[model samples]
Target: MTGADEALARDALRCGELTILGRIRSASNTTFLCEAAWSDRIVHCVYKPVAGEQPLWDFPDGTLAGREVGSYLVSAALGWNIVPHTIIREGPAGPGMLQLWVDQPGDTDDTEPDGPDLVDICPPGSVPPGYLSVLRAYDYAGNDVTLVHADDPRLRRMAVFDVIVNNADRKGGHILAGVDGRVYGVDHGVSLHVQDKLRTVLWGWAGKPIDDETLESIADLGEQLAGPLAEQLREHITPAEVAALRRRVRTLLAEPVMPGPDRHRPIPWPAF
Candidate 1:
């Protein structure tokens, strides 16, 4: 993270309707899952506001600033159906960004045939299944993707939009497959990489030809990017940053079946 990123994070945190849920110990940066008040609805939110400087992890280029910019751009440009809202909150220390949280789907039944955490891909957990089930509850795949995809092409567009955004952590759990079958992506704290930092399992479409609807969406985005959407992003990111994002959009529109991580490439360790 750079100085600009810190400043942006501080600004976002200081101004939203956010209530901290708790600190997430697994992330490298200071992260908190919170609740965001958006209009009449209160949505689950995630905040990653750092109090002090942290080492930069650049395999995924772009600062935290870039990720924030990417989030705003995706929503405005693609209407990817990513949760349509935001909450900027203030901490005793400084500001933080708040994202609309999608409620976790599935029975969440704590009992009955629970499985290993999505991250625990191994020869079955050696310990009692309880430990594995507990851990896997929040793991990827715990949420149901099929239900969300049931009604909307928007869900798939969001997945593709994430690929274009270079989101490195679109884990299964990050996607909320609502009872209404609407899908929302969360934990976009890592996105807008200048490099190929995209490490997601949605590559089920990798190597496949891009569909027409997907291509038109990309085109639609290009038209919108030059308008009000671009102006909105101008407030938080520099003109250069915004331009780079536009360039990325152009690239995606040009080559629908863009290259992603190599088919069998290993997942990047510690996604956030």
Candidate 2:
């Protein structure tokens, strides 16, 4: 989507104009399920304006411009369809980023067969069953290394995207399986770090060898970084940030295999 598309998706009213779809109460922040108009399409989004601390981290002090840029990079880099559709105006809390709403999987009305029991890590009185879940889970700060790949290329792409961003809260709950067997990833506010803060359960592939296809894609991404991809991200992020992302891409491409969590792994506790 062009910057114009991003601009059109914005709603000046922020929280007021958007429809309050629901609320997600997790160990970290209290997110409002929101929807706003973007041309003919209605975008689904989660507005987490620094509610509290639990997942060990929250957005920066004010509007997280980095998230908008990171989401754009992930969506553009890999063919994985991440949500961040638009960046809405913010009040004192934070800028509301509009994301594409993905329909939850396993709905009776849909056709895809069910997979294993994906746990809903919502608080006791919070989550209702049948709602879609993000691929990452809450409170996964201290959990053992668990990867999100299920042999699906799309899912694998999502994992690579998270790795590049140095995501810290990729809990099992954040991975939402759509009714069409497509998984959707969300909750990427705290990313693009210079530290090795990789803390997720997607460790099944850890210590395992990286496949040639993914390796090739990583190489291609590296090349793209110095080309058009870099240009695209320049609109939302600084050139230095783009350069840093390119460095990460190069590291992933040059490395023989992806790294797994070791003694230095950050405690998986939420920072609410």
Candidate 3:
């Protein structure tokens, strides 16, 4: 969607009357698939209520809904549209997060035969030509498999965004290949912690030099965080978390290199 269209959609999500359609059973939290209507516009969205949030030992301060919105704000500031248009509003279950639903390329089977798989597991030594190998392990059937993700620029941008947000749960399923030909990332409820909690399956570009354009975007993001964006983020995360976010941006600017996995658990469980 164009910038204007995205703005309109965000407004719709903010003002629309929400009706819970059904429960997204696959989600760990109590999430609902809902329809939002405002004026003459209608859109599908996901709603996650704070009351249903499962408490985490590490991130015990803010609500997950707020963190999701915070992640969207950072993505919007970067002008990458990596996260879908998202907002916080009262829903059928009280206050919660509402995000525009992105249609994936293969919504039925989660496989796009005519398109590239942004992240996948395949037999050893069968990584796609343009894909990067991440891990080698044995599947449940005792067969050797390799975890890999496509070496696409859009996905690379998302990896950088994950770093800026300190996203702790960027599972393979969280990366969506939208039918609009844009790659989008979802499920940011576990992001923006005060500590370095980055975890993801997209370790393909680890230690590589970030491109010039992305560095420019990160620089712009740092400027935004110092001004209005910082104030906006404070509504969701703590002052310390926002300051840590600024430090992460500045550190990346100084280093200009992607970081490799440094934690004991660098990738999330059930990679897909």
Candidate 4:
């Protein structure tokens, strides 16, 4: 979206009146598709109220919504526009995360071919020409399959972003190809933890040397985290978590290489 459009969307999310349209039943926590209206503008947004957050053993209760907003703040600092315009506000279910909805290609028109999913599963030894293989496995029918993600630079930037945020659930479904020709990641309520909880499906770039331009962006983000960004993150995550984020950035800058999968639970279950 253009800068003005994004500004408007952010304003709507921060101050608009929210009307819940329906529940997203597939979500583990309570999620609603809603309309946020402000002045003469109305935008569709996803609302996940703090009151509806599911208790998790690893994450503290009632903090997931704030983490979502925190993820957006880091994304903005990176200047990558990887996350949608998101904010915290009081909704029908109480204080929660309200994110501007991104329309995926073909979401509103079936005739338009759907955008290519950055991550996918294909038959063994059949990875796409421009894609990179992540893992080899078997499907329910006993057929061999390979997990893969595109080698696109936009997706690579997202992979690096996930590393910086310590994202614990970078599922394939969370990588969105917006109709506006931008890539976006969503469902970041499980990120920004103090420990190394980097679970994801975008392991195609693992072990590769990061490009210089992206490294510059990473360096810029590192500087921000030392300043206002650290304070902004502390509003959502703990002080220790913010400190951990700075450490991750510093480590990446020193190494300048993508990390490989963890020995245990490297990728999330139900990879798609």
Candidate 5:
């Protein structure tokens, strides 16, 4: 999206008429499929109100919205459009996280049910070429089904971003692909915790050496987190969390390698 497009989108989110379309239920907050309108333009957005968030044991309550924005800021500082255009603003239900819904190019044409990790993904004897089956399950009628995913490089990039943010719930369903071959990641409210709770499904590039370009990006972000990015992030998350982000940047730069899974838990629940 262009700068003008992003500005307009944010304006629509901040000042347009917000109409709640419906509800989107997940593991945490009460999500909504909403639309905001302004002068002949209508933008669909994901709305998560503060009042609807479920309290967590590790992370603070009512701060998920801020974390969502923080994730975007980190991605922006890295110079990668991994997350969508997100903003924190007031809505009808009170202040919350409002993210512009991204359109997946040719997304409606994706008849294939394939990705990195999941259970009971497709029907038996229907695995596509170059795809591998990882798990199996039974359909509701007791019919057999198999889970499969293809090796997409987009996921590898996402994995790197997730590690940088300490994303705790990188479920398969959060990954979205575009017709331009660019993948956009969503649902970042459970991320940036000041802990080692990095659970995700994009472990394909584990232990891989960091490329020069990616390393440069990491170094650039580290500098920003210590400077301007730190100022922007302090508006949303705790000062300690921002410090944790800087620490994560330094750790990744020093190690310069993809990390293995945590000993306790490496993947999110309901993986999709």
Candidate 6:
């Protein structure tokens, strides 16, 4: 259950030889489960190539990997470390976002509703205590379901992080329950959008007052957003996107509450 050494993981991601084990068949982009080896250390990492990124009308082209890195920077700035150590570096497939892989418990899905129907129609009965149902819809299989997220403190922290980043996709599958009993968030390529496109599964704190400690964290994030963090982000993302992130941080600090979902669409597809 020990976490991977960040320095070792980052070094491997940067210079180690990557052996692609196989492609993880995600809906949006081509993701590879890879092993990076250098010297005596080996690390497992997720690799998302810029060439494999699907075009989105809203976000700029070939910028997903940078957004992924940007999310990592923001996660680090907030002192949450919810995201794994991620970096943008050249790979066999040109440039990509390489991140350390998180190993989750085998029974992490114990609370997940079984079958397509049960999964799609996430009934309140299926939801564990201390979680809230924020979304309800029918899956591609046409089975009705509800989307629920934990009201746990860790998830609440991520909710605030997502709000600050304007995370566009936060599916249930994207939330990782690490073997070390830590929660991790992955697949941030669709996050940090310039628009108010905060589509996510974490709506448990909507309209709720953010706790004082969490607000302090947000305040620290806001200050960093205006200073060195924005400068660092500029090296990866466009000036416009950096400015947009700054705006989001400012607004969140001003309100200090869990904002509701978008008026049009609130949840990501294939909510698994």
lDDT leader: 3
Cα lDDT of model 6 by residue, 21-122, tens digit: 989976469899999998888989999998898888888643888889999999998899999989988887988989999976554465553333211245
Instruction: For residues 63-90, write the lDDT of model 2, one tens digit per residue.
Output: 3444545665656566555534434455
Candidate 2, residue 19: the lDDT equals 69
* Pairs of residues at least 3 apart in sequence or in different chains that clash in candidate 3: none
Against the true structure, whose TM-score is highest?
Answer: 4
| Candidate RMSDs in order | 9.4, 7.8, 1.7, 1.4, 3.6, 3.4
lDDT of 2: 0.57
Model 3, 1-272: lDDT tens digits are: 77777776777789988888999999999999998888887878999999899998888989999999999999999999999988888999999999999987567676746644789888888887889999998888999999999999999999999999999999999998787899999999999998899999999999999999999999999999989999999999999999999999999999999999988999998887
Task: Give Cα-based local distance difference scores for all models.
Answer: 0.55, 0.57, 0.92, 0.89, 0.79, 0.80
Assess every candidate by TM-score: 0.65, 0.66, 0.96, 0.96, 0.84, 0.89
Better of 3 and 6 by lDDT: 3
Candidate with better TM-score, 1 vs 3 = 3
Clashing pairs counted in every model: 13, 33, 0, 0, 0, 6
User: By TM-score, is 3 or 6 better?
Assistant: 3
Ranking by TM-score: 4, 3, 6, 5, 2, 1
Candidate 5 error regions (>4 Å): 1-4, 105-150
Better-scoring candidate (lDDT), 4 or 6:
4
Better of 3 and 5 by TM-score: 3
- Candidate 4 all-Cα RMSD: 1.4
RMSD of 1: 9.4
Q: Where is the poorest 10-residue window by lDDT in model 5? A: 111-120
- Clash count (model 1, backbone only): 13
